[model samples]
Target chain A: MREFVPPSTRFVDLPDGFAMHRGGTLHGARIAYETLGRLNAARDNVILILTGLSADAHSASHADDPSPGWWEAMLGPGKPIDTNSWYVVCINSLGSCKGSTGPASVNPRTGERYRLDFPSLCIEDIADAAASTVHALGFERLACVIGTSMGGMSALSLLARHPGIARTHINVSGAVHALPFSIAFRSLQREAIRRDPHWNRGHYDAESYPRHGMLTARKLGMITYRSPREWEDRFGRARTERGLRTTDEPFAPDFEVESFLESHAHRFLRGFDPNSYLYLSYCMDQFDLGESCGSTTGEALSRMDLEKALVIGVETDILFPLRQQHDIAAGLSSGGTDVQFLPVDSPQGHDAFLSDPDRFGPPISKFLSVG
Target chain B: MREFVPPSTRFVDLPDGFAMHRGGTLHGARIAYETLGRLNAARDNVILILTGLSADAHSASHADDPSPGWWEAMLGPGKPIDTNSWYVVCINSLGSCKGSTGPASVNPRTGERYRLDFPSLCIEDIADAAASTVHALGFERLACVIGTSMGGMSALSLLARHPGIARTHINVSGAVHALPFSIAFRSLQREAIRRDPHWNRGHYDAESYPRHGMLTARKLGMITYRSPREWEDRFGRARTERGLRTTDEPFAPDFEVESFLESHAHRFLRGFDPNSYLYLSYCMDQFDLGESCGSTTGEALSRMDLEKALVIGVETDILFPLRQQHDIAAGLSSGGTDVQFLPVDSPQGHDAFLSDPDRFGPPISKFLSVG
Candidate 1:
C-alpha cells in the first residue's frame, strides 16, 4: 500500500519457530528481513510487509549480500517506507525460498525434500507465521501492517485473525474479500504451473523441476497483472530481431512483452519455490475475509473493530480497479472508522505499487506520520 | 459498414463477364449479386458492395431458396440502408464461393480444379474482380463502396486499383496499412490451420479437410475479435463442471469468457471452409495498399476521383482503432477528396460492423440519400 524506503535492517532467528497450516511443523525458521529507521523507545514503530505471490519477505533491504531487496528502492532510508524513522520487518515468507522453509527445504520426517508432500497452506496460516515472527522480536502490537497485492490481503487477514493486534491496517491493490475475477486469473496461473510435464505432480526432484510451467504461468499471469495499453506503450509492434521477437522466439519470446515475461519468470525461479508458489497462491484463494463475517461489504466492515485503516488503490489497476478501493472506503467510512483512502493515479496498472512511487510514497508517509 | 434490414430483392446476373486481375481477362465470370430497390435513371442510385475474404456478394437479399445475407438486418427496407429507395448490389467478389471462381472452381487452364493452381490471389486481384462485377452491371460509377474489417480493405483497395469507380467510400474498423501486429495475428491463425492434421499443407482431400485447424484458428481469433471487458461482463467467475476456481486451482474456463471462446471456436468449425479461411487471412496480411500499388494511400485516392468519403471506425475494435480510420480519412482528404469521418462506439470490437448495424446503417443511408 504505502511504499517503504528502508533506512537499516536486521536478520534474526525466530525464537518461537514459524508455524504453518500443514500438519508437519518446522523447527528453526529464520527470517531474512530489514529494519528501517530508529526504533522508538516504546518499540511501537514497527510495520510488517507481506509480499505478493512469488515474492519473499525481502521487502526493503539487502541483508547478507549487496544484491538490493526487491522493494529496497521503495523502502530504504529516505524512500517511501522511510526505514530511517520507523522499524520495518520484511521476512522471507515461511513457505518462500528466500532462505525460508519450502518444498526445497528438508522434511524432518522423511529426511528428504518436501515437494508435493508439503501440506496445502491457507492465508490464515501465513498470517500466524508472520505474527509469530513479530512476537519473537518482542513486539506486542504492530503500529501498522501494510501490504500490497497478495501482501495486502495478508495485511487485512493479519488484522482480522488477530483482532486489535494492529493499531492500524493498510491494504493496497486487493480487497477485504478476494473477488472471483481476480481468483480466476490466479487459478489459470497455478494451472499452467501444475500442468507442466516436469511438475511431476509436484514430486519432481527440486533441481530438475518444471521450470517451463512456471514460465508459462508467469507469462499468463503477466497479462492479467498488466494492461494492453501498457503493452502498446512499451512494445507497440517494435521489431527487434530483424522481425519482432526479443526472446528465443517459439520457445522463449518474440515480442518485447514476451521477453520481459521470460526474464521476470526466470528471476522468480531463481529465488522462489514452485511448490511454495502453489502454497501461497492457495492461501490467497482461501482468503475470504467477509464470507463468514457479513453479507455485504459494508456489513463486513461493520463487523470489524477497525481503528485506523488506510486503503490505497491504483487508478489504472484493471486487475482490481479503484472501484473496489472506493467500495472498501465507503464501507469503512459508513462504519465510522478513521479510514484514509488514497487512490493513486498511475497508468502503470496493477504493478503501479512498484513503478509509480511518487504518487504512493507521499500518502503512505502522511498516513504513517499521522500517528 | 452500415447494417441494413433487407426487403424482397432480385438476384441479378451482369451481361458482361467479371474480370480477374490477370489483365483484361473477363473469362465467363458471371456476377452473382442481389439488388434491392429500383435503379434510378442515370444509374446514380447504385451502391456497389464488395465481399471480404470468405464472403460472397450477397450483402443483403437472399437468392431463391438461398442463404440469408451477412448485412441483411441493416440493409433491409426502412432499416439503416433502407432498401426501399437506395439501389444496393452485393457483388460476389471473383475468388470466392457462393457463385464465384475459387479453389473449387474449374479453371480454364487445363480445365481442371484451380486448387493450388489458382495463382495465389492477392488483395488487388480481388479488387479487380469486384471492379469487373460492378462495371459488368453497366454502372459507370458508384455512389459508394462500404466494407467492414477485411471488406474495408477491399473497398479501399478497389478505390486505389480501379480508379473513377466510386463517388464515396466507407472503410469501417480497418487499417490504411497492415501493421506487423496485423500479420502476426494472421500468422497465428494460419499456423493453426496448417497444423491441423487434415490440412496436409493446404492439399487436404476436398471431402474431409482439417476442421480442427478451423476450430483452433477460431479459438485464437475470438480473443482478438472482442474486448476482455466484454468477456468479463459476459462471464465473470461462473463455474460449469469445475468447482469455483481459486488462486490455487487449475487453468480452466470457469468464467463465461472462457466458455464463449470455446463455443465461438466450435461454431467456426461447424460452418467454415478451412482453405478459404487460410487464403482470406493471408489476403488480409498481404493488404498493404501502398505496397500493392507501389505508392501511398494519398496517391492512390488521388487516382480514385472520389467526391465524398466517409471513413467509419469502431472504438473497441482492437484489430483496428479509430486512429487507423483517421489515417485513411487524412489520406483521402489530402488527395482533394471530400471526407467525413465518423467513429461508432461499440463494445463488440471489430465484429461491430456486423453486430451493431445501427452505428453503420443510418449514416450510410444519409450519405447515399439521392434525390
Candidate 2:
C-alpha cells in the first residue's frame, strides 16, 4: 500500500539559453519534481516512470492526500516496484500542464505565458528533458525505465535519443513509429481545439482557452483510450421516453458512453491545460522512434542494445498495436538482445497497461530484481 | 446493375384512424415511400428491405436516375433480390424524417407539423407504418424481409405488429430487446442535446437549432458506428500539419478512417435533419423486442413463425454484437425455424452494413439466391 513515500521536492534552473531540438530556444526555465523510496548504494535501484499526456509526476503516490497514485497498484511498498527495495521516481514531463515548465509556465524574459510561441517540440526533446531531470536527480546510472502509452513513447524516445540511460528499458503499448491513423485522429483533436473560435489563435490564456475544445478533446481521447466493443457492450443505443435530455429527445444513445465522456472530461479539466493538450497531441503526431535509425528494422535494433530492453503490449491496445511490440521484440532479438516480449490480454484496449499489472508487473519485477 | 428504381412517386394514405401497440391512437396518418426492382407475377416474390434509424424508402437505386440503392449491391435488376425475380421494396416508417408523415409532417387537422404533439410511438407503430405502406403497393405476402441494425429491429416489430408479412427474415446486427447498457448510452446522447442551450425545447423549426448538440450527437454516433481498433490502427494521434496540400499532413491521419468520419458527417448533415435525428435516436432506445407470450428462448422462437432467418452480424459490429445475432439464431432454432448465423468480418463497426457491403453482399447474395 504505500506506493512511493516521496522523498522530497527540488527545483532545477534551466541553462541560460535552452535551445529546442527544433529551432527556437528559451531561457530561465525552472523544472520541479519529487522522488520516492531510496536509490540503493550502487544507485542501480532506480526505475523512472514518465507521466502521460495530461498527468503530473504524481504517478507513484502522493502525500498530504490519502488518495493513491495513478499507478498505485503496482508501485507500492512490498508490491511489484516495491519501494521498500527499489527507488521509484516519476517526473512530470516538459510541455505538460502540471507544475512543470510548459505553455502555462511563465517566461521571465517576456513576463507572459509561452502559449503557442513556445517552441515546437518532438519526443526527442521530451527524452532530453527526462535525461536532464534524471541527471539533476543525482543518479550516475539507472536500472530500468518504464512508461505507459505516451509515457511509454517517452521512454522509448529516451532510450533512442539518449544512450545508456538504463541497462534495460521497458516501453508499454508504444511504437517505434507514429501511424497515419493515429496522427489523423490527433489532427482532428487539434482541429477541434483550433476551430473553437474561442481558441483565439492559441493566445487564449488560462482564463478561457476553449472549454469546448477541451471537452471535444476529452471525448475524442475517450474514443482512443477505450475499446469500441467495451463501449458498445457497456452502452449501445439505449431507449428512453424523454429522449436526449437535449432537444433531440429520446431518439439516440442515452448510452453509458455519455457518462464516460462527462466523467472523463471532469476528471481531466481539473488537471490539464488546453495549450499543452494541443502541443502534446501534435508531438504524438510527430513521433518517429525509427527515424533515428539505419536502413531496416534490424539496423534500428542494432542501433539499440535490444537484449536489455523489455517490450510490453496490451493485447486489446489498438493505438500501439501488439504488432509493433512484436516488431520491437524482433528488432531487439535481431540486435542480439534478450528481449522479454510480453503482451498482456485485456478488454481494456490501449488502457490495459494502467488497468492490469498482474501480467505486466511480474516480468518487470523479475527483470529488475533477479539481475 | 439496376438497383433502387423508385417509382415516379410513391404514396400511402391511412384509410382511417389506427390503433397502436403502445396504447395510443393516430387519427389518419399516411406514410410515403420509394421502391426499387419489380414485383413478380406471384407477388410472393416480394422482398422487403427495411430502412434503418431515420432512413427513407430510397434504399437501393433512385427512380429515373437508376444508379444504385441503399442496399445497392444486394438488390438490383439481376442481383441477389433480383428485381428480375423478387420485387424488392423499401418504405419509410412512421415517425421518421423521410417523406413519411412524422413529427415533421403536416397534421391534416391543423395543417401544422406534428412536432412534440405527435403521440409516442412503439416499434410496433413503426412496423405498422411499413405494413400499411407495403400493403398499399398491392403485395399479398413477402418472400423475405431483410433488415440491418435499426431496420432489422423494424423487421422484427413488423412481424409481430402485422400478421404474416414475410416467412423468411434476416435480422442483421440487431436485437429484439434493448439492453441496459444500450439504454444508458442513448440516455447520455439525449442528455447532451437537452443540455444544449440552442435546442430551444425542440422547436428549432429550421430557422436555427442546436447545431453543436447535433454535432455532438454525430460525434458520439461516430464513436459507436466504428471501433477503437480501427481508430487506433488508422488514426491514433495522427495530424496534418498546417499549409499541407498534396500530402496528407504530418499530424493528420492519412488513414482511411479520417475520410470515413468526414464523409459520414457530411452525408449525415445533408441527408438528415437535426430534430429528426434527436427524436429517432430516442425512439430506437425504447425498442425492446424481447418477449410477449414466450417464457423461454424456445417459447420466444416458437412465437416467431419464421421459416428461415439468416442472422448476419459483423465481427466488428459493436452496437449490435455478434452474440446478439447468435441469440436470435438460438431462439429461432429452438422454435424449429431454419436459422443460419453469419459473422461478417470487418473493422467498420456497425456501419459495416452500409459501408463494407463487399464482404456483406456476397454472403447475403448466396443466402437469398439459393432458392
Candidate 3:
C-alpha cells in the first residue's frame, strides 16, 4: 500500500545513514511535519507537539491547508496551545504512514516498499527522530514539548535521552510502559491482520487488502478507546434500522453500537497501511522507559531535567489509566521538576483528549501561558 | 461441526411440533441433561442448574461419568450446591453443541446437520427447553434455579414465562440485557468468525473449518473474561521462551499473556462447533428481559414470582458488571422477594464465579442451605 500524506505536509530529510535505536540505519529517510505561527527572534516561544499513533503532523489547518486537522479544536490561533503566542511544531511519528518514512514508504536503498524488511521500530527511535526534527528547525531548546497518548511515551524518551531539549513537558494519557492487558489487546489485533490471507506476509495490494482484518482491529480499538459507561448512556440496547436480516449472514450488525463500529472501521480501512500498523503497535508493546536507561521507571523518570511539567489523565481511560499518569507526576516531581497532575473526570476514555476539548483545553493553555 | 456430547448425558425429547420463542417449529428437538442424588417423593428438594454459553449438562462428575465437570469444585455430594441434600439437574442450553439439539445436531426430517438452517435461537427458547426438561423429570417446581453468565438471563426468562417453575433464583454475573459495550465486543467476535473464508456461510467441513476466525474470537473472549489487574499481576511484561524472531512473522506472540491466549484458543478450537458459537453469541446479545414481555426490564423482573433470590457479581467483570447485578436485586426486591446482592471482590472479572470458588462458594452454599 502507498503512504497517505497530505499535500501541505512539509518534510525534513535526516542526515544520511541515520541510526535507529534498536539497531538499524535509514538512508535518505525524512520526517513529515507542519508548523503554525512564527518562532520569536530568540525561539524561546516555541512549543513542539507530538501525536499519538495514527495521527499526522497536520494537527490543525494553516494557510497552506485550510481544511481542519485532527486536533483542530485544541490548536490554531488563541486555542489551547495558541498559535498567537506560541509557535507550534507538530511532527508525525517516524513509523507512521501519514507522510513519514515508514513501512509504506519506498526504501531508497532497494527501491521497494520496506514492509517487513523495515528494521524493527521502537518508541525511542520515534523520539530520537522527533528530536532530530527539532534541531533541524534551528531551535536550540523548545519552550515546551507536548505529547499525547503514544506521543506521551515519546516525550518522556526525548526528555530522558536528549536532556535539555525542552524546558517543560506535557504528558497526556501516556505511560512509561504498556501494561499486560494493553499488550494482549495489541497482540490479538496484529494476529487478526496477519491471519487474513490477503495480508500475505505484508505483500498485499489494494485489490487484496486485508479489509476484514483491518476492520476487526479497528473495531476492537474503538471498543477500548471509549469508556463503557459512555457507550451505555449513548446507546443502551438501541437497535439499528438496518435489520439483522438485511444480509444472508445471520449475525449481521443489529445493535446501534455495532453499526457505529462498522462505520468507524470502514473509514479507517484505506487510510492506514497494515504493515505500518503492525510495526508501530508492536513498538508500543515493547516500549519501556526504565529498560531504555537500565534503571527503574521512577529512577529513569527522576533523571530527566525539566523546569516544569503537566500530566493529564482521564478517569475513564482504560488503556492509560489514571494511576499511570500519577506515576509520571510523582517521578518527575522527584527530579525537582514542578509537576501538576490533573485527572479529569471525562467519560470519553483514552480518546477524551481529542474529543472533549472543553475538559482538556483549559489546563493545557494555562500551563503553556505560565511557562 | 457436530454435537459434542458426554457419554453419560441423558436426553428429554420435546413434544412433536414444539414451538420456538422467536418463531419456528422443531419436530424432533430434544434437551440434554444429567442428574445427581435422589429426589424425595414430594419432589420439593430438586435444584435445576442452567449453564452459560459453551457448557454442557455435565456440570459435575456423576456415578457414570467420573470425569470432572466444569463446576466440579462447587457441585458434588458435599460441595456448595450439596447434591446429597438437594437433587441437582444440570441442563445443556438449547442452542449449545454439548448433547443438545443445536445447529450442530442432525435434523430428523432431512438427516443433515441443521447448520444455518437452524432457526434463530433465543434465551427464551433455552429457558423453555429447560422448563420442558424439568417437567419431564416429574418435578412441579424447582427448589432453586442457579444460573451463571448467559444462564443468568435464561433463568430470568424461565422464572418469568413459566410462573412457579422455580421457587428461587441465583443470578451470577448476568444482565437483563446486554450493554452497548458488551454488544459491540460480541458483534466483532461474530464478525471475526463470519469473515473467515473457510466458514463458507456455515457450511464448513472438518477440513475447511474457520480455525483462524475461531481463534481470534476465542482470544478476544479470553481477554474480556478476566480482569486487567489480574493479568498485570500474573504476567506483567513477562516474555515467553519463544523469541519474537522465531517466526518469519514479526508480530508473533512474544509476551506471556499472548501465549496464554494462544494456548486457550487452540484448546477450544476443535471442541465446539463454530456455528453454535455464532448462534449463542448472537442470542446473548439479542437477549433483553424487558423486550421479551413488552415491559421495561425492572417491570419484567418485578413480575417474577420468587420466594428468595441471590444476585452475585464480580467487581471487575466487564461483560456483566456489578451494576447489572444490583439492578436484578433491586427489581427482585420490589416484588417482595427476599434478595441478597453479593458483589465479589475477586480479580477474576466475569469468570470469577468459575475460577474463584472460595469467594463465590461461601455465599452460594449459605443461600442454598437456607433455601
| DockQ, all models | 0.14, 0.27, 0.90
lDDT of each: 0.66, 0.68, 0.89
Give the CAPRI rating of model 1: incorrect
iRMS of every model, one decimal? 6.2, 5.9, 0.8
Top-TM-score structure, candidate number: 3
- What 10-residue stretch in candidate 2 chain A is worst by lDDT? A1-10
TM-score of each: 0.73, 0.86, 0.99
Per residue, candidate 3 scores C-alpha lDDT tens digits across B1-371 of 44589999999998778798878888889999999888888889999989889889998888999999998889888898888888999999988899888898888999989999899899999999998888987899889999999999999989888878888999999988889988887887888899989989999988999998899899999888998999999999999886555647678888898889989999999998999999999999999998998888777888788999999999999888899999999999987899999999999999998898889888999998883
Model 3 misplaced stretches (Cα beyond 4 Å): none
Clashes of each: 31, 66, 0
Candidate 3 scores an iRMS of 0.8
Q: Name the regions of candidate 2 deviating beyond 4 angstroms.
A: A1-9, A62-67, A178-209, A228-257, A292-298, B1-9, B15-28, B108-111, B114-122, B138-140, B177-260, B291-301, B346-349
Model 1 chain B: which ten-residue window has the lowest total lDDT? Answer: B1-10
- Give the range where candidate 2 chain B is weakest over 10 consecutive residues by summed lDDT: B1-10
Per model, the share of native interface contacts recovered reads 0.09, 0.30, 0.94
